[model samples]
Target: MKPIFDEPEQYQSAVAKTAEALISKFGKLADGKAWEAARMPNLTRSERAYCEAVAVRVTRLVRGGSVPA
Candidate 1:
């Protein structure tokens, strides 16, 4: 079995891919509450957190808010 915290690259890749897909589907009107309502059952808590962060960043950017560096 894979060790916890041993696959950062894979984790980031998965998050990025999922984020892109979510962005494409939701576009500029993406809503965190709506996304949470439709959360994927297969993702772990950490994965969900990362995806939610991406969604928040996207939403902020779309609304002309600056994302923190």
Candidate 2:
């Protein structure tokens, strides 16, 4: 397990992998900036849609309090 922000390398790698997988499964991403774009406070409709589709996994990721490290 890895803390998304505390562990920068792992976080970016995870995001890249997730983005690639998302692209492969769902046509194409509206805003293809997987790294920088994700840091934004507000995501576009397409990004929101993609996140909402996968939000259920957040619980699995959370261990006790944080996202595992």
Candidate 3:
């Protein structure tokens, strides 16, 4: 199916919105579970990639390192 976000700006906006929602829901301590939850089947490849990046950034900011063991 065709993705909703065709333009780069639209994609970025969607990614930022997803990240903000995840951060708000999971708080500063967003873990691997949060990242997993963000992975919806409907997301396009680029959206998933951006979400992964946000997850990593959030994890680093919260734990000051990679995700916990």
Candidate 4:
């Protein structure tokens, strides 16, 4: 598939920024698995939905297309 960014530089910057944000918020990516598995009963309905939406967006961007081999 075509790249999301027009050039490699833009793609690299986007990747770095996203990685830094994720790491800052959650230490390592493996921690995310445990976090997802953990309970969160305190969240209201809207908050839960918003969290789910953000998770979906992050998942898509992380797992989406790649540089051609």
| TM-scores vs. true structure, each candidate | 0.49, 0.39, 0.49, 0.43
- Which is better, 2 or 4, measured by TM-score? 4
Off by over 4 Å in 2: 29-69
Task: Name the TM-score of candidate 1.
Answer: 0.49
Full candidate order by lDDT, most accurate first: 3, 1, 4, 2
* Cα lDDT of model 3 by residue, 1-69, tens digit: 656555666765665566557667777656565577558778878777777766766666556665322
User: How well does candidate 2 score on lDDT at residue 60?
Assistant: 28
Residue 46 CA displacement from its true place in model 1, Å: 3.8
Which digits, one per residue and each the tens of the lDDT, describe model 4 over residues 1-69?
765345666655554555446646665462364236233778767555444444444454455634232
Stretches off by above 4 angstroms in model 4 are 1-20, 23-39, 65-69
Candidate 1: 10-residue stretch with minimal lDDT: 29-38
The Cα local distance difference test for each model comes to: 0.62, 0.45, 0.64, 0.49
What lDDT tens digits, residue by residue, belong to model 2 across residues 1-69? 544557767655665556446545543332343333444569877565445433322322322223332
Steric overlap count per candidate? 0, 0, 0, 0
The residue-by-residue lDDT of candidate 1 on 1-69, one tens digit each, is 894347877755655565556667777655564367447788888667776766666666557777554
Residue pairs clashing in model 1 are: none
Task: State the RMSD for candidate 2.
Answer: 13.2
Q: Model 3 clash tally?
A: 0
User: Model 1 segments beyond 4 Å from truth?
Assistant: 3-5, 31-44, 47-50, 53-69
